[model samples]
Target: MLEEDLLYILALQRVKGIGDINAKKLISHCGSAKNVLKEKRHVLQKINGIGAFTLQHLFDKGNLKEAEIELTYIQKNDIETFYFEDKNYPDKLKHCIDAPILIFKEGNFNLAKQPIISIVGTRKITSYGRDFCEKLISELKPYNPIIVSGFAYGVDICAHKAALKNELQTIAVLAHGFEEMYPKSHKKYVAEINKNGGFITDFWHNDALQRENFLKRNRIVAGISEATIIIESAEKGGSLVTADIANSYSRDVFAVPGRSTDNFSKGCNDLIKRNKAAILTSAKDLVEMLNWDLETKKERAIQKQLFVDLDETEQQVYDFLLKDGKELLDIISLSCKLPVYKTITILFNLEMKGVVKPLPGKMFEAI
Candidate 1:
């Protein structure tokens, strides 16, 4: 159905000013898109805003060769094309007026499932940017939330890297087409990301990454995600634009509080002052604001972490003594590579934790 629907979308997007609203109007007047394509010029003129200027623009792009070229590139790059009507297209982003007629993407990412939090900020970030990124991510990890960011420098890259380092999947909404990488530096990491994450964009291969185009892409990033976080931003920074758009979409917006003296933090402060975003001091606050309960589920996680605190030598000795009980001296000399006296003291702590059983002749076994 997407492929069939794309036939009309590709035709409509090629028009300069004719966007989703106008396209829908035209389709409504003339049945399906397929029918509209075959309809007479006067029928198209009957649609609202389809006067002579709009009609001329429509006819010009309807038969443009660019769509064919874009389709060829889509096949070459293995991009998945999504139409607004398709189930695969994200429901949250569908009602947007500027929602792309077609979205091109790759990888195993599902845009619809999993709650998403979009982290955005300026290219020039601060130490607070890096700190909040790591801290917020660690706190949110238990929820297994999918993180979304623009994949730009500073806060965006920090969020993506932190997610990847934690072995969590993420999504990056790009301002450019899928034909090539925009920043070029991110190319090194994109391949590995494909295994667990993906990049999404509506730009056809022919649609280049232009400065103004980013304004359009910002809405997608804001609309698709459930919430948005601003880490560090100048007063006029682009991250505020994302927050504004998120607010317009009725998505919750959060910002990290920063010192007023810092120039890069001005945007976040301004957002809070304007009531555009709530100030978040910790990721736990974010979790609470979202009404997500991760406290109870993390008890097992804490237990697992505690179990991994044993040193490599202690782990080896513990495993070796598991099957058959062995003397402490033997475990020390053979498994621990430490003095028998030191190993004895270490095993005493394990006893306190009830992780090991002390048997006859100083023998021990995992509990």
Candidate 2:
């Protein structure tokens, strides 16, 4: 994006009543942020959803002054800026309707063609949640997915540390600006994160750290990934809010199940009970569900070898998939006379064997 264009976009972003959704609307109608600001009040007012209050903030001169200062800071620090319309913007996040029109990034990771998953959960993570979160990332290392998290406490930090341990890029989406870190203790990990994955946010360098910023931050965590995984959450928490946002974007959501009495597990269980998220037990479950294992030539060779050694049940499932070409999990269970849960377990084993691949919309096909 041109410096002139970026300047206007920053100014537009500062408009109080105009958010990403409305800013996109104005940009779409006027062709650019500069044009949107240049258009007369009467012209902007005629557009749908452009009402009095929004217009009242659109032409503030202070916004321009602030944008210039922010732009200078950005230039001096060599921070990268991703304009929503830029070709280099995150592919998944770009599709989200409420995604920020501009995002500032401080990382070296490339998001292209890589599977990205956001892991979030309770601030008071239990021992079970910690073990599961760590093991999950360790097992998923072969797929080399970019792990995304809030960089708060508990599950978020666990996921990032696990990713770093596995030598995988992990992104920390911050709630505040670059000028401040939320939990001062986590400042120790910032250099390591930047060395591997990095940080991203829509807020300016000096934007105040506020309660609402977290909710706004959650949207980016949810939108940027193909799936969101909740390791643990209480009955109410920001992770649950992130899951809801992911669902609203029609992305896959997975929740780890816990004992009925575990407080942190309540939110995940509720999501499963309400049919808002699929049950996730192991790394294989997610790998199969997302078809992350079928992407390479070596994996294809493994797929061919899987047909050579099959137990009775594995052979039965493989044969069924071979004949049907592709089928839903429920249909496979019904036709093969296996229970649904049993069928899921069998399919997961089959996926690891590389003879079957899972598809979107809960479908599967034989390799």
Candidate 3:
């Protein structure tokens, strides 16, 4: 979490030719960015991939100073940084071979809290694909899915809109910095997304938007999500690259099948044909997949067995909370089927076993 460590790593990643693998080797052997910056060519020579040209750039005076300047920038911006070793880092992404050592993010995204599923596909998405995205996410609203996707045009944008519509927290894995978004048209959604979710990138504030970054971007989009859903994709594009990377990370991938003759869905159909992706028919499939991993969900099912069916009073209280996540007193006689006096009695018992959280207003939500 220290600014120095984050700055050094971020600066090193910005090197012209260095990639994740090269940067990893440098960090692993040298121990710190400060050490790597100070090392001579001979010291770096011991590493397999460190060439003379690479070493020249590594030890260059300009790069070293730029690293310090970037660190200062981090302090000034209050930019939050996450390292691979950090507890709050995404567990799913940490396992990937090319995972970045540092991720620069803005807003309040809690990567540790839930299962993430990325939905991605063609930039020129069909009406059917957009409809599927909306319906699937709506069905998943009850599970509180934290949807992840590139906030690009077409399918990426559709998934994000659906996530927001369903009132779920979603993360947009950006290809550039929080200071800028590649597609200028998405600037407005980026603002809305900031309030509801977050944007993540490894590149720094001044990082330029280039076509090459999109390739690098795909890895992160796929890495952070538990499962990647390809809604509509052409034979070769960023979405397909992301799906391939998701497979490399040993993550499950699902594809929404589209018309066979449609060029836009060619990549997804090919993946399903090769068994590279599971054919996803609905959001229930994703909900069930994610539900299996929820620790509280299994316990809830068992606890539900205990009650089997709620009594008249219990049913009233339970029914009210099911409609919305609320606090105390609001659950009084209105929302529930029971009256205030009886509801309070049942609320106490439900609160005792950790089934619900009692807020100041006395509203309740499933725990």
Candidate 4:
């Protein structure tokens, strides 16, 4: 985006009562943030959802002045900005309805065509959760997926560190602005995170850290990835909120099961019980469920059969696909006499085993 255009967008972002969705609406109607400001009040009000109150502060001169200051800071610090409509914006997040209109990124990794997943859970993580998180990333290292997290204590930091340990890129989405770092103790991890992946935020450079900021930050964590995993959470926590946002965006969500008696496990258990997330026992489950292993890689039929071992359930699905050539997911479930979710899980296993491949429109076929 041009510097002049970015300045207008930043000023428009500072406008009160106009959120991402509505700002998008206005931008679409006027063609650009600059045009929106130039548009007359009556003309703007004629467009749907643009009331007098919403436009009351649209032309505030102070907004442009503040934007100029921030723009100067951005230029000085060399901060990278992602306008929502830009080609370089995150692909997954671009599909989300409520994604921020402008995202500030300071990172060393590219998200283009990357398999990114967010791992979130309670700040009060248990030993089990920590171990599972570490092992999960280690196991997923071969796929070289980029990890996304909130940069909070416990599970968030654990996920980031685990990704870094495995030599994978990891992005930390922050609640505050570029100038502020919450949990001052975690400052030590910033340098390493930047080297590996770095930080992302929609907040301005001078915005203060606030409780509401975290909730708003959750959307970025949820929207930026192909899936969100909850390793542990109490009956209530911010991780649950992130899971909800992921579901709302129609993205996959996974939860690691834990003992029923454990406090942090309760929230994850409830999410599973409510069918909000799939049960994630290991990294294989996630890799299969999301079809990460089936990127049109072809293998000789003999080689596929030789190296892959299928349990009874996986064999059932694979055999059906082999005989039928290609089948819809629902038909496979009914023909195999398994519940839909169970059938899906079995197919995922087959895909991971390289015995079956997933096609578009929920279709699957044997290798």
Once fitted onto the true fold, the runs of candidate 4 whose alpha carbons sit more than 4 angstroms away are 296-367
lDDT of 2 by residue, 1-367 (tens): 7889899999999988899999988998999999999999999888998888888989989999999999999999999999988888987787677899999999788898688999999999989999999999999998999999999999999999999999999999998889988899999999999999999999999987999999999999999998999999999999999999988776789999998898999999999999999999999999887766554644654566554677788778877766434666765785576899988998888888777899887777888
Task: For each candidate in the order shown, give its overall lDDT on alpha carbons.
Answer: 0.75, 0.89, 0.76, 0.88
> Candidate 1: where are CA atoms >4 Å away?
2-4, 61-64, 293-367
How much is 75 displaced in model 3, in angstroms?
Answer: 2.6
Ranking by TM-score: 4, 2, 3, 1
Q: Compute the lDDT of residue 24 as modeled in candidate 1.
A: 65
How many clashes in candidate 1? 0
> Per-residue lDDT of 204-290 in model 3, one digit per residue for the tens?
777778788887788988888778999998888888888888876656789998888999889999999998999999977776644
lDDT (10s digit) by residue, model 1, range 278-341: 9989887888766565454345345634775777766666554442233345434534456777
TM-score, one value per model: 0.76, 0.81, 0.76, 0.81
* Global Cα lDDT for candidate 4: 0.88
Per-candidate count of clashing residue pairs (backbone under 3 Å): 0, 0, 7, 0
Candidate 4: tens digits of C-alpha lDDT, residues 1-367: 8999999999999998888988988998999999998899899998898888888899889999999999999999999999988898887777666789999989698987678999999999999999999999999998889999999999999999999999999999999998998788899999999998999999999999998999889999999888999999999999999999987766789999999999999999999999999999999999887766544333444465567877788877776665445667876886677999999888888877767788778878776
